[model samples]
Target: MGVEITTHVLDSPRHRTSYLSAGPPDGPLMFFVHGFPGLGAMWRPQLDHFAERGWHCVAPDMRGYGGSSVPTGAAAYAVAEVVDDMVELHDALGGRAAVWVGHDWGSEVVWSMAVRHAERCRAVVSLTVPYIPGGLTLEHLTPLVDRSLYPVEVFPLGQWEYMQLAIDEPELVAEEFAADLEATFAVVFRGGDPMTLGTPSFTSIVRAQGGWFGPSRRAPKMDRDETVLSEELLDTLVRAYGKTGFLGPHRWYANAGEELRAGRPGPGDSRVRPPVLFVHASWDPACETVTSRLAEPMREACDDLTEVVIDAGHWVALEKPGDVNAGIADWLGKTLRTGPHPM
Candidate 1:
């Protein structure tokens, strides 16, 4: 048979991270980090592909997700704490300087990992979100918002108005999402719509409408977008969210101020010397990098960076797995000189 995915739990001194692994134990390590409202299982496609190609691939459910430990307070979810978790997990898994890959909030963690613990990372890859040396928060993000799509007069927060909702009313956002988990997942997990190009993303109006689902204050019922969320994955997500609730995930935003302050640039912050790959989701308007200045900081900071544009939305990996895998495989081939297997 082929490589089989296996679940493994690693307990760090501070927290516990549950992860899925494939490939031989001694193979070159590759850590795949997931984002908000997502579990390690979200990287199933990547894990399978990389494992078959002779890489030891591991994807972890970050703190407050899946089988991972859920800390008591929002402050516990700060970037520093999250980075510590990744570092500790890396150590527990043989302490090799491994390739780090992330998407969305996971990308935020990879950016930090490359900075705070560069010794542990061989190379870094991010999808959807790019690195900001000063930190990826409202302070740095707000100035970069595409003002044309969101006129400062009417949309002060731009597409990130919902982020303010997370900051100002974390509990409310969590409660609303937890109130109707299935509907919430269905609404949140859809594939990108090409028709949304050039138009304001749905996120731009979160503040004006009072919440993700407007006055309803809950996620509206939606069919699972098969293009992005398959039934198996949907079932997996529903079960994961059911146990952990939205509190842990939403807390990620609640700790933004503290995280950003800690992440402010210092002496060597401007340089990320490792070969880097940034995959731009062309249809992800809210995290829109294709037409916005949001990616400029990442471009300026890195010495060797390659960019690819995928014709999918925010959930590019799930929406177009083949394209993503091809991009990554190509990158791995050109960037590193290692053989497929450890032998």
Candidate 2:
């Protein structure tokens, strides 16, 4: 909060972007993009840290989450379109190929940028979610499931069942989360446990259980996980989801299978040519990467790659900000020092 971060807006015929700006305007540019159920403010800790290090930081509320434009349909939240939004935001921020850092679904967008617009990137850093080569659709992910834990007979899609729920019953999923944003955040943002790495994730049973809260179709009442969420962030999330509802966030995953089949993101578009840093959230069962095949595509495709494992949950950035920051900072420092630069 000491870094004097300011909010700004950009409006165009197609969309609107509301972003938080910190550090000197002319300093080395870096962008932090948030994913589903997140706002620009989710990156406040990151923005402040990097800004203090003399890096101009910008974190934008991607398409459906905060002050940004909330388009009505799922197609509007596609990777190509979302990348276009970032392209515009990047251009607006002086057209510098920045060091782009992202999390969750944001990583998908960042990877797409590396594929489609490599020239606009100085480097790419992704936390929790790894680069999925083509895209993060179930098609690519289903094959990568740890079959020993998620057998084909029962857990067809493994930990991604909740995504299937979102894709199948989008409105209901949204309404359930929107019904009690506080409780929703409380359950969703809990810290990860390394003990449960081999165990099945709760997300695997969402469809069979008849939604996130089982038959109740609402989030169960629980105290917020202070280890993963601060009161300010919880309140900000409640307020934001209260205004926008969860539909827009869910929409981001809608039609994902079809989109991949149509080659909008091109499953074959796998090679990544930027200095990449992937943070493995060892305790995060859902986005499990350390022991799973999920990260193989990224490793094979990215010629310049660095990997670090953090013992935190899917909310790795919030659960262990120091580790996440240090990982990225180390990667950046190494990248800059070994100059073939223009990542």
Tens-digit lDDT string for candidate 1 (204-266)? 888788878877888888888989888888889888888888888888886653444644546
How high is the lDDT of residue 144 in model 1?
95
Clashing pairs in 1: none
What is the RMSD of candidate 1? 1.9
lDDT digits (tens) for residues 45-84 of candidate 2: 7887889888889999998878889999778877777888
Residue 278 displacement (Å), model 1: 0.3
Q: What TM-score does prediction 2 earn?
A: 0.95
Structure candidate 2, residue pairs in collision:
none
Model 1, 134: alpha-carbon shift in Å? 1.1
Model 2 spans > 4 angstroms off: 257-269, 338-343
- Candidate 1 wrong stretches, greater than 4 Å: 257-270, 338-343
Error of 2 at 6 (Å): 0.7
